[model samples]
Target: MTGYRRVLAHLREDVLGVLEPGDGLPPERELAIRFGVARMTVRRALDELATEGLIDRLVGVGTFVAYPKRNIHVQLTSYTEEMTRRGMIPTATVLDFGAVAASDHVARQLRLEPGDAVLRYRRLFYADGQPMSVDENFLVPQHVPGMAKASPPPSLYRYLSEEYGLVIDWGEDTIEATSATPSLARLLTIDARDPLLKIERRAYVGRVIVDFSVSYYRADRYRLSVPLQRPRRAQQHRPVLRGR
Candidate 1:
């Protein structure tokens, strides 16, 4: 094996196996001396490890073991539920909440006319004390009365299910990559213009649309896992020649 590959294997199996997340690894010079390789060789190995999400290299700070990314499966689940399932404590802080007149886009999503009242709320969600995402939601007011007056709950889906008997049967999500704005970056505790995962969702109960929401998640902390299936092949049909 090459010097760098040997170093990489040793780091992965020996060093990282003994180290916990956020624990700092030895300096490049020390590692190179121990492995009998050049410092650049050691660096190459570390670079590959970083690319594989096994470690994080901070400028002027040093390298440390990286925390695992949270996986968001393609399933109908609330943020609270998803985090709880992964054994993380989920919490939410309501940034803003009140009744508001629906705009043209929101009205269409909720199947209501423009100027109709809707409960609008913005929340910052955390998992295990780390900021995860910011969510802005619009709900059809008639279905969830008094939600605006009361303190917003940690889990909107849970609150809807228990208080109003409004269970979300299914939801559709549109996901894309976006850069965080200055205000959003501050709220999410991330650097300005950092990459973010944007998700827009419309949730329904039976045939009625009840919720429209947009969420932005830190890309480094979260990833989406989707299962895909191959399409079936279409059967070929032969054309018959007509006799004159």
Candidate 2:
């Protein structure tokens, strides 16, 4: 990275640590002199930070720290399902809904033929009126025909399980870090460059693949945990005997 960016990062971290909620930061000239950089560099850094919602920059005054992001728990379930299980009312606003030709990645994930049409649904989910996540899902139209016409329920899994008699027996998913896109950032009300958790999940009903979903979770809100177990000594290996 550039020296300016490096200094900016350090100052950003320091400011975050020292700043109380709503506390303003030092003046730009002071910051530049403190870091031995040009005032323009400090201004650029501050602009980046402000755009990310980490700080609120006032014109005549200095910048102030904003409230910390919310903490959201992520599980092996859909946003609506998980929130419902927690006794929270889950709501969804459909962002994009239509059929489209499967991309190579989506085709591979859903086991679809190249150029085959797939039903795509994108929705922003909320819990108790607060934005929780955005889910972009792709599925074979034959498997869930007329899904769009179906009474847009809160949970898709429940619809499949109850109405269609398709029980989700198992699923596999991968999670990684990503930056929100401009559209996604606007929907989630965060900065586009904000770090986020991206989950790619392929759900199965018995042995049949049902749906493939790519979900973007706000990093400040979501943390995923997986439990691991140690193998038993007997299962692991046999100890070598040494003659004394």
Clashing pairs for predicted structure model 2, backbone only: 72-221
Candidate 1: give the clashing pairs. none
Per-residue lDDT of candidate 2, residues 51-112 (tens digit) = 77788776676688865554343334656556666787878898877788999999999998
Candidate 1 whole-model C-alpha lDDT, 0 to 1: 0.83
Worst 10 residues of 2 by lDDT: 235-244
Which regions of candidate 2 deviate over 4 angstroms? Answer: 1-78, 84-88, 230-244
Which candidate number would show the highest TM-score if scored against the true structure?
1
TM-score of each: 0.79, 0.64
TM-score of 1: 0.79
- 1-244: candidate 1 lDDT, tens digit per residue: 9998899999998545788876999999999999999999999999999999989898888998887789767665777777888999988888989998999988888889999999998999899998988999899988987788898776787788899998776777788999999999998898899889998878877778789988898887888886666555795322111000
